[model samples]
Target: MEAVRATEIMVAAGARELRDGQTVVVGLGLPQVACVLARRTHAPALSLLLEIGVTNMNPVDTPIGLADSRIFYRATCWSGFLDILGMNLHRGVVDVGFLGALEIDRFGNINTTLLKEDSGKLRYFNGSAGGNDVASLAGRVIVIMRHEKRKLPTAVAHLTSPGFPGGRSRKDLGLRGEGPQRIITDKAVLGFDRGTHQATLLSLHPGVELQDVIENTGFRMETPKTVPATPLPTPEELRLLREEIDPKNVYLG
Candidate 1:
């Protein structure tokens, strides 16, 4: 069930966007799964700009990381780590960015920094790489995370990377383009209300009810009278997702 949820979220995240020839900046974890699935299933020609600087890589198997050999073997160019942020991302060339967050607020601020403040205990989880640049530069940002009260918060404790940054801060900073367009999770799909930047329930998964989604969220959500169930994965999509993208089932675990 957890594997199904992870695959569903990855496929939903991949299905959101990526025109046939657009370039996307992909992060690790679920973002990697979605990017590969996008290339294989929907946008075959989509160019993937990996965090470690592999541009336009099409891999038979999902690479473990940016340094994976498949990246260099399939890339148009392999750039240095610094070049990805200082040059490519800063240039606004990436059409989309797929990211994972520990906690995401209603305004779309993401926190991957730390689970707890004084925890040298959680050091393994406290890394923020390319998230700031991806959120800032990508034309569109898609966040994939587990839907739980702990992960979906009214406000993030720390803003490792700002997406909406709240209306006031965004307006004051004169930021352009809508940030963090959508968040795809295990139980439902959510989007930021255009007027308030507050999270709005867009739809729910099959067998998932409104109460199930609402119970997981930390705040009151404005839901439509009718929320549709997400479409089930096609046979081919499911097979490809399980075999090629996540053979080891890392995401499922």
Candidate 2:
């Protein structure tokens, strides 16, 4: 018997957004797993750009990070970070960029640098190395994060990477790409409203109700007139995700 885990549902939601032939800039974490699932399932022709300067690699195992050599398993090209980031990404040629954050605001700003503690002290986290650059360049960014009230704050304590700064137009900020197109969470999927650019509930995961989403979110989300439930992972998707993509349960677990 095949069982679908809740985490797998989030992974599949990320994969469903990918197209057949698009260039994706992949960061570490579940974003990597989601990209791999996309390639192996529907978007076989997807070109993956690793921060380490590898592109279109068919990895056999789940890589620990961008520096993992598994990224070079059968790479189409091995270039330097300069060529990938400066030339390609800066030019906004990459179609989709996947990211994760510890704190996200209603405006989509992300804070991975620091968080406030109960004692009123600032606790530092791993700083954004290339995330800011990626958000600034990718044609569209999709953030994958665990859903929790605290993580989804009304405003991030510190902005490590700008999403739609203050929900302003991308043109207003002189950004090359549209910031944070969608946010995939364990409980629901949120997208930016076209006019307001505020986080809007797009769909809820299976068994997650409207109130459940409302309670978990830190800020008030714009509820759509008709919020659909995210499609559950099919047997095939679950099999591929579990057996082929992340057999070791690195990210899916």
Candidate 3:
């Protein structure tokens, strides 16, 4: 892991979370690379849903983005947003949802909208796009974000995706999914502590230290007595990622 780039490690960590035959809602960037990697390796039957309505795409080449026509090669169908998000997701047919965040709190609440500056200025972002739907309706959500103190605030200025907001229950919010099941970062794999509703260290990356994880986070995360290191990416896995998935070094670069 030390020899590899951080983004590569992040992609590997992301790819490992996907299980065989699970219908996953994924975006175009690193998540798509992860999906392609999963299909080439252990999870050959994993189905991918792109936000732009392409379903079950078997990409012949690494697509630059959802707008790239390469994803349409042997795609299952090209439905509209209503069918994918309004129906499949709202109906709870999707098993997992992948989301990226501008900021995430210790409770996992996400902010993909505007960032509030110290002067009370709002720096607007593309407000939610399909993130709200994906987070709200999927069976379970897995967030992909790089761990940094600025991005990992104690709380987001705005809550675009609910993740145990204020340490409450999802049932109370009436959200369909199980909220955030896992948070995958370059440094560690984290899961919420049931008692504290705070991010807890589930596993660390191969060369990342506990202090590194702690110092980078905006809030204090609970650490167990024994934390396992995330399994290093296999050589075959690396090959698939480099030669097959993202040969152009699009995201893995």
Candidate 4:
């Protein structure tokens, strides 16, 4: 069996947030791994809606990206981005969405566009490929990313996807569903404050300290007086994550 790793632990943590029978709109990378693990273990009835137009695919292998051929294997329906993003997402049918951002602010607004500049020109990372739609329209959104001061900024240099912008309701922005609900990181799981929508420390990862979370965060966050440790991955969950879901540790790394 593969040794439990930080990335694997993060994936397992993210998977626990999903419920069976929910329609999950998934992005590439760690989000994909988490959704796949959930489907195989706890959320078997979970329907995965991909950004690149595949839905409910019983995928066999870990896909590197949304366009990977493996995503279409045993897929239930075949469509284009227009039908998936415009039809289903626009209709607000995606119950949960898994996303990542280069930088995320305390309010959950994401920035994936540009991190730095080279040669006096802006250096762009992957642009918003349904991130805006997913964050805006998914019934709930979960962001998975490495926990670090640089990645968790007080404010993103630019906002690529809106998340309770200025603590306004989704309806106020003409969006259909609730905005970001959770952020799963390497060291902690952060949830939004119910009233203010600011990031709040929900739980610390095993062996991680509240001070670690605060020191790593670039901006001020709501810290609980006593943060319970996040539940560790069970033996069975770790087994399936290593053997069935990602034997090669493609995304577990």
Candidate 5:
């Protein structure tokens, strides 16, 4: 247990959100690792689709990127982006849009592109390679990112992907994908309120304080009556993570 790391916990938390037979469109970073963890654990039938045209990915090692050969290795199907992003994604067959973010707001809006002059120093990101499309088309979305004040801003300076925006709902915008359902971070798991769409505090990780989540968030979130400790990763989950999934510390590192 002592060797278990925060990144492991984060991956485990994100993985648990996936059900046994859900279809997921995974992004490049921790999201992809979490998807793999899900398939190897409880969701053995989980369909992992990368927008880069790989389907049913069971990577022996965490891929460096969506285009990495390891992600395509032993995959069930190797189609082009049109079949994946254009067809499966656009057709609304994706069950989950597992994504990472540079910054996310209380409304779950994510910014993976440039912060721009609004955030001080102007910076350019790779833009939303498939982020906007995934968020717009998946049946539901889940975000995985580190817990930090800067990363969890009151509002993202640049909105690369849509969420439950401050004023309008995803439906009002005519977006097909259900907006963010859960945000998994190192410190806590935050869920969106059904009515308000605000990122509500749900559970804190073991040894993480309420104040830790609060202070790390850019905007204050409403505390529920009970914020339980996140269920620690099971022994088997930890074992698989360390020994099978990321033994070399690729993504877990």
Candidate 6:
């Protein structure tokens, strides 16, 4: 069930922006899965720019990270890691940015730096690397995370990457392409309102109730009068997801 939910979230996020012949910067975890799925199922012509400097990678299995050799094996072009960060990312040529986070706020701010409590007990995970650049330069940003009260909080302890930090408002922030365009979770797919920057429930998966989504969110949400149900993965999509992208069962059962 978790596998299905994770895949659902990945695909939902992928479907929001992936287009043929576009270049995308993909982070690790769900972002990797989503990129692979998009290349195989939806946008075969899409070019992937991996953080480790492989571009247009088409791999049969999901890689652990940019360092995975499979990415180099299928890449159309390869460069130094610093080249991808300093030249490609900073130049604002990436069409889409896919990222995974431990916590995300209603304002589209992400936190993958630390896990802490009210008492300041900190348990650190992987520290921020190129996430700041990915959030800053990509044309569009899509966040993929699990839907839970603790994970989707009203605020994060540390603002590792700013979401609309300097802009006068959310709309102004989006003008620079810094704020998140969409958020996909286990239970539902959500997006921030263009005008208000408040998280809004966009679609729910089959058998998932609106209340289920509401309960997991940490802030007040704008739910539509008629929320749509998420389309189930087709047999071909399922087969590809299970057999090609995640054959080792890391993301699926």
RMSD of each: 2.9, 1.2, 1.6, 1.6, 1.4, 2.6
Residue 73 CA error for candidate 2 (Å)? 1.5
The prediction achieving the highest lDDT against the true structure is 2
Each model's lDDT comes to: 0.75, 0.89, 0.84, 0.87, 0.87, 0.75
Candidate 6 colliding pairs: none
Q: Candidate 5 residues 1-253, lDDT tens each?
A: 5566789889999999999888899897888888888888899999998888899976776678987898888999999779988889898788899999999999988899987665478898878999999888899899999999999988998989999887468888888877899999999999988888889998999989898788889988999887898888889888888888878878888
Clash pairs, candidate 3, are none
lDDT of 2 by residue, 38-157 (tens): 888899999888878898888887887888898789988999788788788887789998998999999999888999999999999988877888888899999999999999999999
Quote model 2's TM-score: 0.96
In TM-score terms, candidate 3 sits at 0.95
CA-RMSD of model 4: 1.6
Give the per-residue Cα lDDT of candidate 6 at 199: 76
Candidate number of the best TM-score? 2
The lowest-lDDT stretch of 10 consecutive residues in candidate 5 is 113-122
N/CA/C clash count, model 5: 0
After TM-score superposition, the amount by which residue 121's alpha carbon in candidate 5 deviates from its true location, in angstroms, is 3.5
Candidate 6 lDDT by residue in tens digits, 183-238: 88778888878766767888887888998889888877999999998777766676
Error of 4 at 91 (Å): 0.6
Q: Which is the better candidate, 2 or 5, if ranked by lDDT?
A: 2
Between prediction 5 and prediction 6, which has the larger lDDT?
A: 5
Q: Encode model 3's per-residue lDDT on 25-114: one tens digit a residue.
A: 986477777777888889989988887888888877877777888888899899878888877887789999988889989888889999
Model 6, which residues run further than 4 Å from truth? 1-6, 165-175
lDDT by residue (135-218, candidate 4, tens digit) is 888899999999999899888878999998887777787877788989999999999987888999999888887888899999
lDDT for position 54 in model 5: 92
lDDT of 1 by residue, 24-141 (tens): 8888777777777777877888878777767777666655676678556666787876676656677767778888999998888899887754653553465578887788777778
Provide the clashing-pair count of each candidate structure. Answer: 0, 0, 0, 0, 0, 0
- Which 10-residue span in candidate 2 carries the lowest summed lDDT? 1-10
Clashing pairs in 5: none
